[model samples]
Target: MTRSSIRTSLLALCAAAVCTVASAKLPAPSPEAAAKAAEAAAKAAWAGKVDNYKLCLSQDKVAAHYRKTTPSANPAAAGGAACADPGPFAYTPPAAKPAEAAGAHSPPGTASSPPSTQVPAAAAAPASKS
Candidate 1:
């Protein structure tokens, strides 16, 4: 390469480096500049799709599912329980017994087990040594 070309290349590289450093040290863009940049970006983003931007965005999101990382399982997180091999409803209704079967059915005129007498015999008993 000629001396002039070599010097030109070095000058170009130096200018680029100076601009990069200066830009890094510069204050953040003003609100107006930021808004302008955002407007420009948005225009560029949906350049052709002024009407069908929503459809385009939805399609892009669907395509991006393949590129997205699978979320890692968190031990502490609660997850919905779904039956992989669902059979019949797992919940069985409580076995229905007639009130008469459990014990003598209280007459309609009387109240059922009074609150004071509601304690079971085992619970009413004092704690026993094993």
Candidate 2:
């Protein structure tokens, strides 16, 4: 390559490096930016708790099982157990999966065959000693 072209490339690289360093030296976030970030973090934390709350509510059987097993001494187990799910809240039931049709269960040619009910003679005998 020509000397002029090499010089131009080196200058371009130096400019990019300077720009990156200047950006890295930027001042800390403004008060408004900090406040906005704090608010967003609070919302995220609340969302996580809300999700866990919903999960706890949906796990009625788990809560019941814990309540059944947990002793009366350690009372903290009641969070996901006895009565700490959610209260006075609207609950939307989960959507149901579509059921497979009865005809789709077996191949057409084998659908009418009777199932084998007899045990094999070898399997019927107990294992012999070596």
Candidate 3:
């Protein structure tokens, strides 16, 4: 093949690959489809916290956690949107939730306070018959 022909073929391959990748990504959904998807995502995200989501304008606590952790770049309030934070390590001892609160248990001797509603009782046996 001539040099020009080879260059053209390589360019065409690159263009085709780009188009294929772009098409695989999400496209502009129709209004109805977009609304349906938004509704589904909202339902799934807020699953059991519809009331809190409505009241706070966000259903996910992950965003709140991020807001608290990151510092804001803009002078204005983030309006519930998350800003960047230096990190928990910036604090003297790092004010993080206790291991039990995060559902993590330490070794037997190193165990901290137990979580609320944690029952340490052993399984009860059936009552003896007369």
Candidate 2: where are CA atoms >4 Å away?
1-23, 61-130
Model 1: per-residue Cα lDDT over 26-83, one tens digit each: 6789967876786676665454344355555565565456445446534334333322
lDDT of 2 by residue, 108-130 (tens): 56556457648876787868989
lDDT pick, better of 1 and 2: 2
Clashing pairs in 3: 69-85, 70-84, 70-85, 71-84, 71-85
Inter-residue clash pairs, candidate 2: none
Q: Score every model by TM-score.
A: 0.23, 0.33, 0.21
The C-alpha stretches of model 3 lying farther than 4 A from their native spots are: 27-130
Where does candidate 1 clash, by residue pair?
none
Error of 1 at 11 (Å): 8.7
Model 2: per-residue Cα lDDT at residue 118: 81
Sort by TM-score, best first. Answer: 2, 1, 3
All-Cα superposition RMSD per candidate: 29.1, 27.7, 23.8
| Best-to-worst ranking by lDDT | 2, 1, 3
Residue 61's lDDT within candidate 3 is 54
